[model samples]
Target: MSALLPLPRLPLTALAVAALLGAAAGVWPGAGIASAQGTAPTTQPSRLPTAPAQSRGTAEQASVDGVVEAVRQTVLAAQVPGAVVALQVKAGDRVKAGQLLLRLDARAAEQTAAAGAAQVRAARAAQDAATREFERQKQLFDKAYISQAALDRAEAQYKTAQAEAAAQLASAGAARTQSDFYLVRAPYDGVIAEVGVVLGDMAMPGKPLVTVYDPTALRVSAAVPQTLAAKLPADAKVQAELAGAAARITPVRTQLLPTVDPATHSQTLRLDLPPGTTAVPGQFARAWLPVAGSGDARVLVPAQAVVRRAELTAVYVAGADGKPLLRQVRLGRTEGAQVEVLSGLTAGEQVVLDPQAAARIR
Candidate 1:
């Protein structure tokens, strides 16, 4: 025989409420209806807004990054090998044309010059003696005291001596010119940007000793790609300014180099800055060059629409059915907040402005 177990009794109000909740769960198909009336349902986020792809103009302008440089920048090098004896100017010092900047040990040059001078003197003395002898020979020939052959020899000696004197004089001048190489002078009026050698430092021929730049004249040099360079007009109006500057600068002139760099596939463009610009060499700058035509269709998209994943770059484009799809695109130069799409995208397509927001759509 099994022992009889006693059942615990519940309160009437609690029993009635539990019965009602059970009935409601059974009546509803899933937890959705019950949660909608009692508890809150987890809400899904909405997709981000999409922007239409814009067609770039046939003639669009591209921005160029470059460096500011002086019109006349020279690195003076040693023409003769010698030890530096004097360095008159330091970095940032103002200089004038023909100003002495440095001096090298010229003892050997001086000695050589002195020897040449002495040879000139000796040659002159010999020439004078020869002249006197020739005159005496002439007088003797007139008196019939000297043979015709003796007079002829005396005349030949004088002529030979005169030639020797002239040769020596030229040699002396050449030696002096070599001696002048020991002295370094400023080739133009400018500021000394750098001093490469110090006093007592040995300088070899063709080694740089000093660098100078004319601060008044400034220019910006930039390398432009071959494709865009071809579209530039003959007298394209260009605007340039210092990087992160607050002022706009009107270029004095613009010049495109005739040669192209094959390795970079770019051509050099030089823009002359107007007078009184605070631009200096080695500073960063930018120039806006007008493009005449691309000769092909291109898409332009907002910069934020592009998504980057390591080496992969893509954008979320809206399909024909209005569904978001990922697209890989090749990018060209950037202008302001928009980027030129070279391929993998076409005009009239829509792209999600925020890629992260579009990820939740699926």
Candidate 2:
């Protein structure tokens, strides 16, 4: 049988084993395989990593939420009860001081005024005649052409007529003045924020006809908690954003209302706004009230360093062994990109920039 085998054939398994060994020893299997396996390793220089440190001397700023309000708001009411015959202004209309806003039915008043004027003219003529007659009677009595009794009668008549004329004149003047109340004019320069009267509508005395507001005098009114109320300064600076316009206003005054709201447990605070502002009433706003820093300094970290989980907020602080250690933090004010750390971390301690990575490591 050995003679019939002619030559000892090398097995297919032996060939494959030799090829694999050759490829492993840096020998080429083919052009593609050789390129993939025999190529020299790339030499990429390693970069020195830079660590993020806590920013220093960052001034902490406080923030509070509030609403925009107009400091000067007026409710225009009809002085006399009458039918609203005309309306010269509508809501959102700008008006000047003393500008006529509306008109009431003054036809009857005008007629009464005209009749009063005529009566006043007649009374004046009668009073002049009475004065002349009294003088003539006095002269005739001095010359003994008239009896004392007759002269006294004429003087009494003259005096009575004079008194009547004087009363009539005052009544006429009053009627004329009353006629002028038909026209309603604006008391000051402002914008009409509301209109409650229309043409032919009956307007009553003391009923609001329109609501006007001076946009230049705007403010933010907020109810601050009592615990934080003491920290608010009289001259505190404020910034308000309303209807896409932001304004910088100073606190002209701060008033704590006598009673606290039962539901909110907060006291009302009225903030005087700056002039030439255009914030509308009932618009929500945010405020910042500055509090003095404690004498002992504290460190600040980036905003991303803090993580909120469930009901707790925490940060990952690096230990001496370069491993992240989870620590709860008491956060304070946020100044731009940095946040004030009130507790949990020390001044020189390092906090991880990526909290998720630190959490996974922990």
Candidate 3:
């Protein structure tokens, strides 16, 4: 009766586990906890045999679900605060590097730059007058027409004017640089995935305005438990199945992140999709990474063999006497027509194919 009890406090029906199973959705239904009180005595199922890893396929211990992402995705942000004045591109538009994407109001920056230029011109004129006056004073002092004190005053004024001119020139250059910020350009050649602004929208520094991504290069990213991370091989043949796609994606490269996520106790797994693998960012995908060695190799049984019930997943095993006993098992990734058994069953053991028939035998 304890086995019949719900896994936790809540007693939900078997239907709750199916949708959440994701890629494991192809199995048959049988999710109830059978117990001694049920008074069922069962015999071996109609078909009895051990399904080996070689027969099902040399695959992963479990499947890790992930999302397809572009290898180079960037979000363009505003560096200068202004209202959007012109929008040159929208979502789905292809743009070249340095191509104009949008424009912001630059009337204020333009005025500032103009004023700085004017100051530079005025300071240069002052510097020219000061230089001529200093030269004339030096000539007068050399000929004894002016005192040394008078010549020194003229030299000081000339130096001051030269410093003012240099300062104004630098200020003008900075103003000119800031004035160019009103135009926003793409950093690379890619397709625009999103546009977060419209004409007349007020833009602020660091505000995201566009999202672009390269379609030629992409990958699917998934997170796997750290316990299993050590067993993934760098050259392992990782395969990915995209939602609604018939073909499985073969990755050109597999990358395992060195750092573990403290909160999830998992590490990120990256599978670089092969070139021209028709996939877009944000699409859902399931990846199967081959674990190193066969020491902990798992078994796969037909989905019909496992009974899902009351938020619990269990299966019926045939004993040596051909009598069946209900055993609880933890479920792993579900591939087409089969599910991986993580625990509660050993290799070479006979698993009843039909849970309904096994329930009758029990």
Task: Provide TM-scores for the models.
Answer: 0.64, 0.65, 0.62
Candidate 1 runs further than 4 Å off: 1-60, 292-362
lDDT for each residue of candidate 2 in 1-362, tens digit (9 for 90 to 100): 35665787876786698778878988755655678688876643222121344546543445567888777789988777889998999999999999999999989989999999898889888888988998999999999999999898888988888888888889988988888778888888999999998899988889898888888877787777776666666665544434455454666655557788889888776776667655678887766666555124656888888889998888877766677777899888666788878877767677777777676552
Better of 2 and 3 by TM-score: 2
Prediction 2 TM-score vs. true: 0.65
Residue 69: error of model 2 in Å?
Answer: 3.3
* Per-residue error (Å), model 2, residue 314: 12
The number of the candidate with the highest lDDT is 1
Clashing pairs in 3: 30-307, 30-308, 31-308, 31-309, 40-362, 41-361, 41-362, 42-361, 42-362
lDDT of 2 at 331: 89
CA RMSD, predictions in order: 7.4, 7.5, 20.5
Q: Which candidate is the best by TM-score?
A: 2
TM-score for model 3? Answer: 0.62
Candidate 1 colliding pairs: none
Arrange candidates by TM-score, highest first: which order? 2, 1, 3
